[model samples]
Target: MRPICLPERVAARAFPPLAPIAFACSLALQLSPARAQNALSVEPDTTAGSVPLRVLDARVRLGGERVRLPGRENMGLAGLTELLNVGGEWWVGPGVYGAATGHRGGLFVPGVEGAWSHPFNDWLAVDTGVFAGGGGGAAAPVGGGLMLRPHVDLVFRFPGFYTGPTFSKVWFTSGQINSNQFGWMLNVDSSFRYRPADFHGTATDGSATGLGFDHVDATVTMARPRNSTSTAGTPMTQRIGLVGLRAERSVDGPFWAGIEAAGAGSGGVAGYAEVLGTAGLRFPVVGDRLSLGVRGAVGLGGGGAIDTGGGLLVKASAGMTLRLTDTLGIGAELGLVDAPDGHYKAETAAVSLNWALDVPQRDLSDWFNTRPGTPTRMEFGTGVERYRAARKDGRTEALEAVVLQVNRFVAPDVYLTGQAHSAFAGGAGAYSVGLFGIGAQMPVSQRVRLGAEALAGAAGGGGVDTQGGAVLQARAYADVALTDSLSLRVAAGKIKSVHGGLDAPVVDAALVFSFGVDHKH
Candidate 1:
């Protein structure tokens, strides 16, 4: 069969509008944004140079459930989990691979996951994997609290599309008061990889090569004309060298699009990765196995790269691809690039290795999983606390203190908390007072939360009327969540000095930032 190129007029109509949400949450998980470009380096069982490692396989998921815990009523929690892991993997068989990633959410979950992908034929496949993690937390006082997830994927290989069902079990902890707490959830995601060969004029199946593929190429800029003419009036060819990775999706027709982020900063240029969005057309020449295309894009050029006011950029290019096999291929392109306010421009050319990411060619080695997220909400703040009272001998005092608070979502509208404060002002000067206690918080709205606590720790610093004595404190406050982990607070409380026999009042405010996750439901 021969691959055909669509007429320019017809190609323009090939793309149809898709829903906006269609752009997000396409898979239960995506190995990586550039999974295919990195596929060739992965091997099923090769002692290859230092085994492959995956660093920070970050994943984000939406949807949750409400469950009942021992001694507690049913709590409906908005399910949101953030994980970071460092691990290695090995291929088990023709359609199977296993990997372990250290996971952390509200609790510590570290486990292994395996996938078995069996091709129904060359165009379809079935894939399944089970993921598990175990670790210790406040609830899992002894053994590790665990998490298990099993998923199934139905894949359309030719188009590189996959979708399926996923089920998961998230555990809390095992403690003396009760035993354990956990939740169950189910969700679905779908997405497709760009198949360069599938686009109009890209190429046909079982080809030696194809046009329109994701690739990593090395480029050499042979000529860069300067604003001022040379003595001889000929443009000098500097021949600057560079390398980069390009991911594209021309899945629909002759037009393909994707992001290109590559780096080159050696030889006095300042390291920078040129990232751009591209769209283009393909023309088939010999049969359906080889084709040529032209692409145009505009984006910012940063990383010290020469750019005008805002680092504006534009690139016009022509390229060709030849498939050596069903999955392996080669490509080269010549481009006219202008950046940094169009002050810098060059005529560039380069070659690339086109590798398509698919089940049959996937090899997992030194891959990693890590990322930062607010798994729980903890705040650190600063405020001024004061006290006032009546009594012939009762004294009033004011102090500036540093406050630290930790909280967790317990119910839709409530939170459990622990707080501490160390005073640096007031009559005691430096060695003043310290307050610590447990309390509760309630969110009155998306941004505001009301709270109260009682604390008693140590009191007294150097002074004629001083000696260390027990300090008692209590307060009520209102805090507003500023971001995923930040907040601002206003509070009022009472303090009593046991040794000085005085009653004090506290009035203060603070800026707080949470270090972990907060109530989402």
Candidate 2:
């Protein structure tokens, strides 16, 4: 059965009250002097005379709210962001929000956000923020899925964290969801050291200090549904195929923590997804070459007709990892997944290829230490794209997306990129794409360059027939320098499913930020 599309009348109801709220908050942030002086401060000795890129703030927020999903029901969203201080009392960065309530599990939104914060005294402060993004899933009634959320919080400050009560409003520009709710929030403070974009040198000391993660893994998973029941109490029989990404950092001797997010790419369950927090302990069996581990995770998951009441799930696994190199490993796991409040049970097996990063951990009070002469050049950006005449469920329509990307220069005129696209228009709110590949460029002038790229990734959902979710895309782009560290880019591209009937012409525009970091080899 096909899902219902949103009503056309919701498009005209875009909220107008946000402009004043945004303006007032901006004014308050600009006039405040409370959080300006030591915004990016680190220890004086190791960071002296160094002009490195800095992570001004890293925060994780968990919140809950109730919405009108045909009836009043609870929803939870978790947020993470790495912000850079722009000026006095203001910070801006990229952030992602995902459903953690399990009731409507497949919700994911990737967006850009800004915040204003000021201290009232030594122990109390106010923080306000606004997020703009696009996404939808689980047949939710978010038309076009362009979502906006604005929030205000009053927090009690501690040494390295804050606890607060928050009030927020969530609205969709072309959808039938307008919700206001109050929730509790917790925020942690953190920082990391990095290098400048123009850095091209060799490190003398054996140390690294950029991108605080220690490891990343790409996973392919297969699950056998056991005793699973549909939302309507019907019997279900389907095997699920999922692709996922995991990132983690060590906390103590053998303990580590991380985040994992995955989506179903096959098995007729396109809109099923989960975002979870994981912790584990690893013990070496063969002196850094082989290891065994046990991991446990809990989070929200639903959608795809699997009944996960409130969307909460827990999983446990045992695995072994074999080190192929100093920086790479392969692993396999056997696990049990269960939804306590819903009728879902599964036994899963997964294989993963992982890469190791050596960035050391730094606390909120300390700065990252990078060895001099490390060479890392990169660009990060966010923008929008439009797909003309995309094929979905035997029909064709235009779709719009919010895109986030990172480019790492391997040579002066050559680079590699990773990108994500989330659909927000044309009744395709649940559709998304992830891609990685290579590109080349040359300078036409001091301010302009042209380039082309080819990429392949997995995409599904929104009833788009991606047939196992493999896709390829190629694009040509023009970039114009706006400043030494910023540029404006526009591109035209073609995207096609490898085994399905989704072929579309895509056009995009974005603003890119360039940074460089020095690290040890």
Candidate 3:
């Protein structure tokens, strides 16, 4: 904490009736002359200025009402809310608030909140920030999930403690035909603050102040994942490997927030690029050699690793760093990350090299952010199929089919499809059908891919007596990539052969060979 005494404000603001806590703060700041200004006796020493920029705190946030989900049972505010937070805050630039852990919604209101703060004096400050991210199913509401929080507080400098009231409201960008839900609580916190220059001994000039410099970081990650909503009969993806990069600076005092980019599930079934916003606080742990901190983050991207094909996600983690030299340090963390579709709940471990660009040495505010890789791709293939046809004329026959198809990805996990197929039997003439429509896909791991598609097109051949008609089809399949240019798939689907006068139901199994086309942004 800085030892400088602050000058008192000119007047006291009236306390509002809704918050008794704010009323107490107003009274204290108004009546306590000894503490209203110059509340501490510590002196500022230029020789002792190398203190690491930091902010650490723990609090229990009350999420107080019940939120109604579409089909699942309603959950109380406590259930929809985060339970507690054991993390640090970055007060640098715009400010960052985060906490990574076993589950996401249990702290810091379920995701990273970027807010700004202003200190009135040595004894008071206020903060405001917002949170918006997506992952999970409709159980979390539609694609746009959002939260906002505003805070007010009083500080006690001597023993390093603070207390205040915080309020919040959360809702979906959509859904919630009922109403929005709000939560509030009393935040009692203890924090340790520091900055990079604080470790540089008295280098009070240049980049150490982070005034005109850039902050950069690089790291490698490994995580063990559990299958995302896959059943006992489906293929599964169980792990991921990632390499990442970050660039950010403090907007507030010790709070750092920014975007991070990474490539996970490479050289396997999990191949895609992702980007997310991450934030956290860095505080002093062992003078100049060690540092400990907590981090919170959320992001969106596409890859099989993201079970919903491509969607929003949340992650929570804590880590430590050992400074090896002025601009070089190594760190690692353990945390959990989950996807929106409930496809993956990965337990992760990562190691990184933390550095500052300038020669004087500075601590770069760490916030996690991300950018998505090419989540869109194309597939075209041909396969052999078999089906039993029950004709309207009361004739039933077994047939052989030659099926050709093309699929195009339009979103992270959705696709548009078109296909043509021909069937032949000993006494029966050739039967053909063409189809067009949309579908969805999911990656179970690096090698397995699963999806389903629907299409409608023109039908002709002897089955239609040369008078072509319309045909509709729906199919689901599982794929195993055999090589960079090859993949094999197994599928089953229902075909409505209305044009062929064999309209009841036709089912077929196909052995397909697939190759990809470019994924242009």
Write down the TM-score of every candidate: 0.30, 0.82, 0.32
lDDT of each: 0.39, 0.68, 0.43
lDDT at 423, model 1: 31
Write one digit per residue (lDDT tens) for candidate 3, span 5-24: 22111011111111232223
> Which is the winner by lDDT between candidate 2 and candidate 3?
2
Error of 1 at 162 (Å): 24
Q: lDDT by residue for model 1 over 44-94, one digit each (tens)? A: 322112221122332222222232434553322222222222233211100
Q: Which scores greater on lDDT, model 1 or model 3?
A: 3
**Highest-scoring model, TM-score:** 2
Name the candidate that leads on lDDT.
2
Runs of candidate 1 exceeding 4 Å displacement: 1-225, 228-238, 340-342, 359-521
Measured with C-alpha atoms, the lDDT of residue 164 in candidate 2 is 68
Question: Which stretches in model 3 have alpha-carbon errors above 4 Å?
Answer: 1-66, 72-139, 143-168, 177-202, 205-217, 226-235, 243-325, 329-351, 356-521
